[model samples]
Every structure is written in C-alpha cells, then in structure tokens.
Target: MANAFERLVEKMDRATLDRMGKPVLINDVGFVAVESHLIPEMGPLTGDGISLVIFSSDYKPRRNDQTVWDGQSYIVTRYQSFNGKPQVWLE
Candidate 1:
C-alpha cells in the first residue's frame, strides 16, 4: 500500500509543484512547500483571510508555533496531515 507521503506526492502535479511550490526553511528544515503570495495584515487592519498554506510530505507545525519562510516569520494557526500531505495554515 502507498504511504501518506507517497499519496501526497502522487497527487501533486508537476506544473503546480514547479510553479507554486518552492523550497523554504521550516524550523530550519528545508522543504518544498506551498506559500501564499498574499500577506495577512496584522492588528485591526487584519482581514478575514487565510495567510499561508504549506504542502509538505512530512512536516507538521503546532498551533501558535512560529515558522520562517522567505526570510519572514509567521505563526501556525491550524494544520492537518491525516490524509496525504501535511497542510499547514498560518496566521
């Protein structure tokens, strides 16, 4: 049977991975994950929008933990990795 990581990789298309997915350092670990171009605003200016989504084979972030991407820092607000690839949502 295919493992979770394998399933995730299989589901990812070459074009999407090549275009949108970029390698970034997560907790200093290198991973090819998806990052959103739109940056969420802080404070009262912040709107109802998801900040970032990370697609990785085997990386999970605890809620409220800080993560760095593209030289910027963000906090992980939600995540799920039961199906295939781990999907992390940043706030």
Candidate 2:
C-alpha cells in the first residue's frame, strides 16, 4: 500500500510528464515519455551527455540500454530512483 505522500508524488509525476515529456524509444522497441536534459558538469569535466527523467511505472532503465530521442541515439550509463521517479544518465 502507498502512503498519501507517495500517492501525491505519483500524481505529480504523471502530470509533469504528460505536460513536458518528449517521446523516446527504448531499445528500439517502443516509445515512452521522458523529460530529457543536458547532463550537468561535474568537477572539471564538461557536460557532453543527456539526462532523462521518466516515470518508474512507465519504464525501468538499465545500464547499456539503448535509447533514441529526437532521432539521436544514446546508451544508458546509469539509472537511479529520484523522488520515486527513474533518473537515467546517457552517453
């Protein structure tokens, strides 16, 4: 069972994605909604990758999974849960 806060988070996640997500193909199989952004710089390394936020209920990402967004390909480098959502790092 989910608590009230968790239920609220789920609602907000769905609403946010519905309003702002872009289509992304996962492993060339099907499309899922994701909020994609440029990877942020860490230390002295410049950013040259993509970060994707997607609903966990929609898709569970794994390392090395291929994704295509805006006609460009990317490989998942990392995946973790953020605020009950899935945050994916791609290169």
Best by TM-score: 2
lDDT per residue, candidate 2, 1-91, as tens digits?
A: 9999989977887788788877778887665566655434534535666777765466878899998877888899988886667788878
lDDT (Cα atoms) of all candidates against the true structure: 0.63, 0.75
Please state every model's RMSD to the true fold in angstroms.
6.0, 2.9
What TM-score number comes out for model 1?
0.57
Q: Write the per-residue lDDT of candidate 1 for residues 1-91, one digit (tens) a residue.
A: 9999877766664556788877666676777776544444533534554444455656766787677766777777777663355666665
Which stretch of 10 consecutive residues in model 2 shows the poorest summed lDDT?
A: 36-45
Q: How many backbone clashes does candidate 2 have?
A: 0
What are the TM-scores, per candidate, against the unseen true structure? 0.57, 0.70
Clashes of each: 0, 0
Model 2: lDDT of residue 52: 77
Q: Clash pairs of candidate 1?
A: none
